[model samples]
Target: MRFVIKVGTSLIAPGGRIDTVLMRALVDQLDLERHEYLIVSSGAIASGMSKLAFSAKPKSVRLMQACAAVGQSLLMYTYEQLFFGKKVVAQLLLSSDDFTSALRYENLQHALHELLKLGVVPIVNENDSVSVRELVGAFGDNDELSALLATAVKADWLVLLTNVDGFYDSAGRGQKLVRTVRRLTPKMEALCGEKSELGTGGMRSKLRAAMMASENGVQVAIANGTAPQAIRNAIERKIGTYFPATKPAPKKRAKAAD
Candidate 1:
């Protein structure tokens, strides 16, 4: 099965630096040789903050861009070192226009197919170094980008990994995880809120992306990236909030005469 795994910055760089422990754990948990796997990762800016000596997320777009430029390589390097002998990993820096442009989109599609065929895993991230809009947070966050990529690649599933365990609802006195959401309701969508200190996306963006993917025939799962067996659990429909695909009715076989 083809799956797009979007890793949030919160999980990758919770405070500022690349959490090697978490990264190692995630890498060790992943065993997707037989499946077509794509990772749309966030955390360049967060990772850059440590390298650039910034204590907090920068306010300037130029500074943010600089951070992304500095952090992107570090992000990939970590992935490279972890997946060294286990699997080959390739980096893909993308812009919103890449998908808007028919040729670029198709070329990317071809390149990804080739990489997968060659037993390589493509690790994708927004081209924050040069993408003006991306730096300024114009286009939707990586959550939305993952949905777009999943659609472009016609992936069977899109699993969004975040700090939150799953979609939560305010129950009686506390918040409770909503395990299965057949359809995202208006109330549920309203629950999405502010972003973390290090990243732009939040629960709302993920829900929107999930709804979009589900509408276009791609199942979606939102789970805690740090949790044990997160990816496996999401794929197995054992944990997280699952959104199954909604497709056109299948043609029915005609009834035979008795």
Candidate 2:
């Protein structure tokens, strides 16, 4: 199965520092020979903050971009080290235009498919160092990006790995995990809480992304990134809030003759 796994900043760099041990554990779970995996990770800024000794995420756009510039390298380097001798990994820094523009989108699809064909794991993130949209509250902290990538790549599963186990039902006396959500509703939106301090997206943004991917025929699972074998469990529907695809995936049409 092809999976677009999104790991949030909170899990990647809790306390504003990259957790190499935790990251190694996550990497250890990858079964590259059995399935294809693409990672959409968010942590360049946080990793930068750590390297620069910034206590918190900077409000200044330029400063945040600078942080991304510094951290993106560190982030990819770490991934490269972890995946060494296991699988070749490629870094893809993307912007909204990559998806919005027709030519760019087609080119991106071709590139991604080609990389996958070579058995390379693509590590994607927003081009935060240059993209104002991404740095300034766009892409919902890479949630939307993952969904869009999943749709474009025709991924069978889009697993959103976060701190939470799954979406919850907070209306009752205590919060109850909602195992399956076939369709999104107004109530789900109402249940959303605030965004994370370290990360831009919260449950609200995740739900929105989930709705988008599910509608595009990509099954989505919002599961806890910190959980043991989280990726495996999420794909198997053993944990997290599963959103089954609602629409059929559009068949890829052959290019017309010039």
Candidate 3:
């Protein structure tokens, strides 16, 4: 089955830098998966900030963009090394316009299909290095980018790997974890928490991304990226906050004769 795997900054760029140990482990997990997979990764800015010797995410747009510029190359280098000998990895840095523009969108779709057809793994990320909107968080960033890709590709599943294991029942005692969410509702949406210290997205953004993909007929699962078995568990439907694919809403019936 086709899969879109999104790993956030929390797991990838912990403590404001690329966590090599965690990344290697995640890569090992990916190596075990025998199915087709596409990655939507976030952490270029967070990882870049450190290379520049900045202690934290910079406040200025120019600084963030600069960080992204530096980070994108470094990020791709790391991925290339990890994915070496396993498969050929291609980097595709995109902006919001890539998905919004009709001609660009078609080209992207064809390119992605060709890559998958050729057994090449495309590592996708926002072109934060030069993206004004992405640098300022003024549009749908990686979370939504993943969703858009899932919809466009008609993927069977979209797996979101976060720092946390999965969504929890906020009002439940001890905040009970909710597994296998069959429907996305208003109450469920309210359970989302705030964004992480180093990333633009949070449980809220993930839920929205899930909703967007689910509405387009793709199932979703939210799991912990750091777990050794996250990739396998999610595909087996044995763990994570699973959102099953639902039937599309029926079209309105024609009006009866007056």
| Cα-based TM-score, every candidate | 0.91, 0.95, 0.90
Better of 2 and 3 by TM-score: 2
Stretches of candidate 3 exceeding 4 Å from the true structure: 31-33, 171-173, 248-258
What local lDDT does model 2 show for residue 115? 84
Model 1 lDDT, residue 57, Cα: 90
lDDT of 1 by residue, 76-185 (tens): 99999988888899999999998899999989877777777777889999998899897666657798889888887778889999988888886345888888777778
Residue 65 lDDT (model 3): 89
Q: How badly does each model clash, as a count of residue pairs? A: 0, 0, 0
For model 2, state the Cα shift of residue 122 in Å: 0.5
Give the TM-score (vs. native) of candidate 1: 0.91
- Report the Cα lDDT for residue 152, model 3: 74
Off by over 4 Å in 1: 248-258
Task: Please report, as a residue range, the 10-residue window in candidate 3 with the lowest summed lDDT.
Answer: 249-258
lDDT of 3 by residue, 118-215 (tens): 77888999988788997666545588889888887778788999988899988547887788777678887787777888888888778888888888
